[model samples]
Target: MRHDHHGRTHRLELDDQTLREWDCTVVASDPEDGLVLDRSAFYPGGGGQPPDQGVLIWGGVQTRIVGVRPRDDLWLVPDPDDPLPPAGTVVRGAVDDDRRSLLMRTHSGLHVLCGVMARDFGVPVTGGNMEPGVARLDFDLAEVPAGFKDDLTAALNTEVTADRAIQVRVLPRAEAYALGPIVKTATDLLPPDLEDIRLVDVVGLDLQADGGTHVASTKQIGRIEVAKVENKGRGFRRIRLRIAD
Candidate 1:
């Protein structure tokens, strides 16, 4: 396994977005909790994207993994009552590929929406959330003009058809900050001791500090339809979106 600057093992999935399964050794496990693998392909949910669902195979038994969360280390929470494999046990982990693919599409679609908004409206995202086929992004805006939804939807689809390549990179925290990556949360929310940052770049479109899975290209996002736009409060508005299959 590889190690990061923090002395922790480098997440294998982070290095290869397309990886859906991996062989790993169990670092720890519990009957009530779940297994902690030395290396895991499951993303321990964060940054608005939910955790991955999968299964672990060990000792001629298959255990369904229903949830994952981060403690001091990433923990794979299997379905309730699932037996736990002992530490050092070699296991195979597999992510639900279809579900993960949908998440990647939805996540990338949201970024495309962000790019369109920033380019056309000069607004930054304040917050957001995502699921398999849908997502919503909150933006700092006092008001939107009539027909804003239709216009925004058209622009988003245009970018999808443009098929810009999506790129991911790791950079020094200072350099990333200097590049002005779009952040939905407060800057201070980022750890001060963070020496390196992962940046997602929608080439020629958008660049942001993000740690979620995404497709390789904008065309993979397909058509994005605006479902609703609600005014959350003064200077805050939310846009909902769905991807056409």
Candidate 2:
């Protein structure tokens, strides 16, 4: 199945892009190092995180994908400096699994933090990004007491112990809005339409309309630590955090 929009070609699969290496047929090829696969899970990164970089293999040739750019309903990337594959060639595209897994973990971890902050402290997330071992989120707040930070950290670690299932699903736009106030502040990257919306729900904890890879369970995120909280504006604060083991 293919749903092409916003330079997103294969996101309809909704599987972790880096971990699973699905063999595919190259429906089309470009000598300028451009190629298109019948299927892919590569995250042409968004939500502030940079795009993933890795390799694509076609029989005896392996080409690096250094940059990812989106145009129309397709994502474009260079096929590294290597022999070209003619149209109708079969190839296997893979992303850096280690980096992608870390990103998935960190991205889901942020949701926990965001949820905890929203319920306990009434601090909603403004924006955020996740790296392997480091991540930061922006929240609207006047001032955050240190005690609250420690409590927040403790709360997040506690949730990891429960090991909640990280559920992902797509809902119609009206159904999404029916999620009520919890999703009020979360961002929806989906195109505005009468179509269904993709949502990541932390099973009984938090839910948000999103379009990124995530861990199957909260346990994979382990413990999350709120490392630092900086005052970005008069009433805006940014919290930096990370997930471990």
- Report the lDDT tens digits of candidate 1 across residue range 1-245: 12231123247767787998889888887876677787777766777899889899989998899997677667778887666889889999899999889999999999898888888878877888999999999989877998999999889989999989999998888898898755644344676786788889999989988888889999998888999999889999999999888
Q: Of the candidates shown, which would achieve the greatest TM-score relative to the real structure?
A: 1
Please give the distance, in angstroms, between residue 32's alpha carbon in candidate 2 and its true position after superposition: 5.1
Error of 2 at 153 (Å): 1.5
In candidate 2, stretches whose alpha carbon ends up further than 4 angstroms from where it belongs are 1-8, 12-19, 31-33, 182-190
Which residue ranges in model 1 land beyond 4 Å of their true spot?
1-10, 184-188
Q: List the residue pairs that clash in candidate 2.
A: none
lDDT score of residue 233 within candidate 1:
93
For model 2, the local distance difference test gives 0.72
Worst 10 residues of 1 by lDDT: 1-10
Candidate 1: clashing pairs of residues:
none
lDDT of 2 by residue, 122-179 (tens): 8666777777768998888787776877887899988887898988776677887788
